[model samples]
Target: MKSSDISVEAKGVSKNYSSVKALDDLSLSVQKGEMFGLIGPDGAGKSTLFRILTTLILPDSGVATIEGFDIKRDYKSIRRIIGYMPGRFSLYGDLTVDENLSFFASVFNVKVADNYPLIENIFKDIAPFGSRRASRLSGGMKQKLALSCALIHKPSVLFLDEPTTGVDPVSRREFWQMLERLKTYGITIVVSTSYMDEALLCDRVALIKEGRVLSSDSPRGVIDSYQNTLLAIWGDDMHSLLKELRSYNEVKSVYSFGQEHHIAIDKKLYNHNYIDSLTQKLEERGERNFHIKVIAPTIEDCYMEFSANKEGYE
Candidate 1:
């Protein structure tokens, strides 16, 4: 990609909070109008990176740029060009929905009427409760209102930190739909989430853990990196199945995955007859009503693989 097409850039950015390092030489780029996701568990430096890029906090080392402007010297200009919605609801609880929107617009030196078109699709659902105080709104409604206020200024890039963390399932789905709509307006979006499944929704995602990036690629790309033979096994008694699978000397790892357990075996021990041999062994042990089948790897599976690899290296 050309330099002109980049909306956000970070080069070896790092942050230290006293004895703890929040970010460790992190570097990445977001192209114009792209929906980039930062995926990781809590305390994985997602929030720290977001805070740094949004100019709410400064990094301890390295450098970053927003719209090609230096983060330190050009922060004033960067602030005007980006919209930020923190993980928590930071709006005025005492103020009504209408008041919050109007206040943010005024702060940006713009009128709500001027940017109504940009936010109408998201704000319309909560418009009927315009008189309601922000504190009284539901989790989903508050999210929409916050998003509306963020867009009121017509920012070129938006930063959202765990926007769907506490929302309901339906609301989470709806929130992503709203993001999809926003992408069509030529706005670059950078969002962070702990939900591994949400990674599939982004154009690209960077898996982070303990202040380091484990991997960065499209969802499919990450899964494809799992160059291992995996199988899903389940039985009438999941506990027994898990225990029996773990006893196998060839099994590398076994973890519960919804209705079944995803079992990874050392590639050297795997063969076309491996499944048959496992079934026969289970049958010999009087394990009835069990099934084993090869399966595709998921984002969570890939994450676990990376985590395990890191641990082994250490």
Candidate 2:
């Protein structure tokens, strides 16, 4: 896409701390007004990338720009035009909710009333707690307050680093709903999360691992690219079933998925008769009452497949 259409762009960015590589040859782009996600596990370079894009830290090499402004040269400009909510609640513990909001607004040289329109929906839920110390707020309430502070400046692009990490299920859902509402206001959002389930909520996602980007695509695109013949198997003894499945030469990979085990098998070995053969083999191993069936792949499954493939290449 044209540079004007891009809200953020990272070109061959790399960072290292002594011997540990935090990011390596990483690159991705976020379109204007799009909700993009950096989906990966902890230490997968999501936070490092966020820090680079937000101009909190500079990359050892390569370049990144936010809103057409260079992250290094125009960091001051970038800070003014973008809102950032770090993974942790860094607001002052001694400050009340309203005081914290006012502090952030003052830093941005704007009154809370100036951008109240941007944060009104989120602040309303916490308005009654305006007098409560930030440290005394519940996890969900703290999250809402942090988001309100981030939006108090009406930034064009918001950077949220693992916004839902410590939140409850209900609050996580509510937080995503707030994001949906924010999108209508034409703000570009780049959120990083280790939760695989949240990938579906983004317009597009970049799957990162071990300081590199494995894949970047729409959620459906990633799932559709998983070519493995996955099988969901359940049995009397899940532990033994997992062991037996792994022992089979036909099984490429196997892992527990809730109560059942998901195994990836070679396409050549996946057939109608393969189930019967698998059952017979398991029966000889003293595994009985096991059921096996083909299953569709999920974003998690695709993530595993991509991660495994990347490992093989390395």
Candidate 3:
């Protein structure tokens, strides 16, 4: 991508805290006006990378830029053009919704009314409780209010760190919809989320683990890159089934999905004869009541695969 088209860039960025390595030479780029997702679990360095890019903290080594501004040198300029909503609620709990919003607006030397149009869609949801203290708001309402404050300055780039971690399912869906709307206004959104399902919502995603990016691509691209043949199997005796499958020589990997267990096998080893042999073996072992079928890989499946083979990825 051209320099002008990139909204965020990081190269070999690393951070260490005492004996812990928070980020290990991590690097990625976000395109302007695109929704980019950093998909990972806790302690995967998502938060650390966000802090480095937002200029809240400096990296131990490597370089990063936001809208072509050096993170270390042009931090003041970068701060003015980017909006950040931390993983935790940083707003004063004693402040009312309106007060919180107004305070943030004032900090940026702008009036809430001046950028009302930019956040009207999001603010309208919490406007009803404008006079209510932030501490009294629901998890969903608090997030909406936080998002409103982040956008009050009409920033060019927005960084959200696990914004829906504790939100209800309905609220999570609504928050994603709000993000979609923001894209239309030519704002670059870089959000970090641990929800595997949410990874599919981004235009592109970087599957990260242990301070490293195992894979980065569009959701479909990542799934398409999965080389293993996946099979979804389930039965009454899940524990026994899992143990049995793991003992099988052909099974490459197995994970407990929501209601079913997903197992990976070499594509070359997948065949009708193999299935028949496996079925017979299970039946002979007193596991007659079971079901198995080939299934398409989901983002979670891909993530597990990538995480298992992190050394193979750059």
The TM-score values for the models, in the order shown, are 0.95, 0.96, 0.96
Candidate 3 error regions (>4 Å): 311-314
Backbone clashes, each candidate: 0, 0, 0
Q: Per-residue lDDT tens digits of candidate 2, residues 1-314?
A: 87799999999999999999999999999999999999876789998998999899999999999999999999999999999999888899899999999999999999999989888889999999999999999999999999999999899999999999889999999999999999999999999887788888999999999888888999999999888799899978999898778777888889898998999987877888887888788898898888989899989888778777767741
lDDT of 1 at 34: 90
- Note each model's CA RMSD in angstroms: 1.7, 1.6, 2.0
Model 2: CA > 4 A from native = none
Clashing pairs in 2: none
lDDT of 1 by residue, 1-314 (tens): 99999999998999999999899999999899999999877788999998999888999998999999888999999999999999989999999999999999999999999989999999999999999999999989999999999999999999999999988889999999999999999999999987777888999998888788878898989989886789999879998888887888888788999998999877788999999999999899879998999999898888777777767641
The ten-residue window of minimal lDDT in model 1 covers: 305-314
TM-score of 3: 0.96
Model 2 lowest lDDT segment of ten: 305-314
